[model samples]
Target: MKKRIIAVLMSFVAVLTLSACTETVVELNTVSMFGGTDANRVVYESTIYAFENEHNIRVKDKSQSSDEEWKSTVISNFNTGNEPDVLQFFTGETAKPFVDAGLVMSIEDIRKEYPDYAKNIDDSVLGTHSVPTTGFVEGIFVNLDHFKSNEAKAYLDKDVWTWDEFKALCAKLVEDNADVEGYKPIAYGQNIPHYWIDHLVAAQLGPDYYNVIKGAEGEDKLTNALLKLSEIKDYLSYDETEEFSSQAFLDGKYTFQLDGSWFGGRIELENITVYPFPVVNEEYGSPLLSGFTSGFYITKKAWDNPKKRDLAVKFVEAMTSRETLTKFVTYGGGFAADSEAKPQNETKVQEALRLVSPRADFVVLPLGDASVAGTYAGLVEVQASFVNNQADTAKAAVKTYIEGQTD
Candidate 1:
């Protein structure tokens, strides 16, 4: 009986030791475009750090800039069987390659195992991607301080702000700041002119940015839109050195800066306000660029692995949580993916939402985002034509966009 008792105690102790020693530690491989020079880098790192502290998962992040070359490399990794366990990438037509290949997992299939995953973000927001919005909108970021005077303030108060009204306001601003040498009413970088291009195209067509109804080379509407944009070039700064430099705008050199919602996060400017671009076309209301065009994706490789599957899902869930999404809005100036997520009070984030949140009924995205993959890069060429006073060659830039698929 004593020997039997000793054996039982030893077995119980062994079981206890085993239970205490056993733990799940997953090394999740992840990739994102939020690495270098990303506005949300600080918040993104903090979220990942917090997730690590709470879970037994250690992230092996391999993030890079989402440039064309990097995008090509992402597809290369998938082809070479080196895709990350979790990825943040563009959805829709951009991701159609990998998605069609059945390499990325879907929310519908994931629901079979984890029924309650990603239920926080609304269905309309989720659409077919089943991921929270991690995208931004483009708009006019104006220094309200520049407009505190009666002359500019009246423009804002006007019930109908048309292209004519906009031109007059620009002329007035130039006259007021006559002492400021070479002062431009609109600030933008010659290198990055896509923001204005998107709105110009949208004003030509409609606000349905998700599907650019019918835009192609030699289209008269597109030509007219580009022509209009160039017509107002006298008010636009053609600075190659400063790409919407916040410092330049803050210095009161430029009254209006064209930028994305992401540009205004945690900015210290006191009298900054965001307003919709003028309805230049009159036929179509000004198209405001905003909302999610991309999302966190889980690879089939991660889902197939018994160890990485749950950890991957948990990581995505944490990344897209209300708290994290609030950071995305408050710090990153992105649209809040979670309904509970709210921006910091009195921030431009709130101002941006005030400008576009009314259109929450639709899943609107940037006008350029709907273009075929690899075609957007060609826009840089298109911009050069107008910026250099060569409006006649703008159509040639559009022709550069080969009507072919690129992963």
Candidate 2:
């Protein structure tokens, strides 16, 4: 009888142990575009660690380093019905196919269910990711030390300036800093000159010109914009490669850099500033190039799993929380979708947030992506030739490029 009692007790203990093991086996799979850089990776890993600690759940992180690779991986996974529980992807038109296929959960419904999670996040930003074709802003990064050293602080200090005044200031900076070896008024990548010229054309003309630029009458406008940008080619620090230009900007060799907000954390500059491309038309405010929205999306697989759904939501909440988003902004130097998350220790990002107007005319740059108006390979090539002192061929090149696009 004593031996029977001992066996029964041992069986009971074994059953309890099996139940505990089953309870602790909950797992959440995740993938993101944040694995490319050290700063981004550190922040992402810390967030994951905190979430895992708090929830006592296993997080299977499958993040990819390359943006192109990440996109391909996610798309393939989604199509194969093997996508992770949570995904970080380009929001806007890029996400539409996934949404249409019912792969993404309704974040709106999630917000309704978890009001605490949605609190303080900007409605516009949330909407941008939730809806189709909604976008975000792009602007320039300035080296504050270079600006102050060249006595061109007034251009940024003042609220507004005309096209001519902006040009004169750039010219003056080049002339004033001519004695400084390797110094240039502007630093920009050869591969992305079209990105800079797009902003210039939008500022000089208006956002409407983007739609009109492919027409026959738009040839003159395109030529004029090209000529205006070409005027500063002599004042620009020309590098054989894009990476060199970015390095030159960080080394204080250039006063102005036309790049998106991501540039803030990429460089180690102590004093940097950010501004919208200055306005040329007084009737319109600064022309902002609206880029694709990028954010997290909950996969249908995660949402359908009753056991893991709430845990996934909690992870999203932790990732998008003001504290986490603030860390991203402070370290990565990009605007956060969380409205209440203020940037700390990043002056350039702070100034950019302050300067960018909600009321500004937001236009999409014609990057070859699906979100923008359309892509013209010839447009980029012609701009390059114009900047390289082949100005005489630029107008004809521009015409040919537009014609090809129209055809």
Q: Which stretches of candidate 2 lie over 4 Å from their true place?
A: 6-10, 13-25, 34-39, 67-70, 91-96, 106-127, 130-195, 201-272, 279-294, 304-306, 326-377, 380-399, 403-407
Instruction: List clash counts for every candidate, in order.
Output: 2, 0
Model 2 pairs whose backbones collide: none
Ten consecutive residues with minimal summed lDDT in candidate 1? 209-218
Q: Mind giving the per-residue lDDT tens digits that candidate 1 earns over 292-336?
A: 777899999999999889888999898888888878777766567
Per-candidate TM-score against the hidden true structure? 0.58, 0.61
Decoy 1 TM-score against native: 0.58
For 1-407, candidate 2 gives per-residue lDDT tens digits of: 99999999999999999999978778899987778564567778899999988888889998777567667777887899888898777765567778888888886677676756556555434543342112245666677765544357667666555667767887778766777887777887777675666676677667566556765577777777667766677777777667888888888888877776556657677777666677767766577665536677788788889988898888877788878877876776556665456667546456564345343544444434421234466666666666764656877866775665532
For the record, the alpha-carbon RMSD of candidate 2 to the native fold, in angstroms, is 6.9
Each candidate: RMSD: 6.9, 6.9
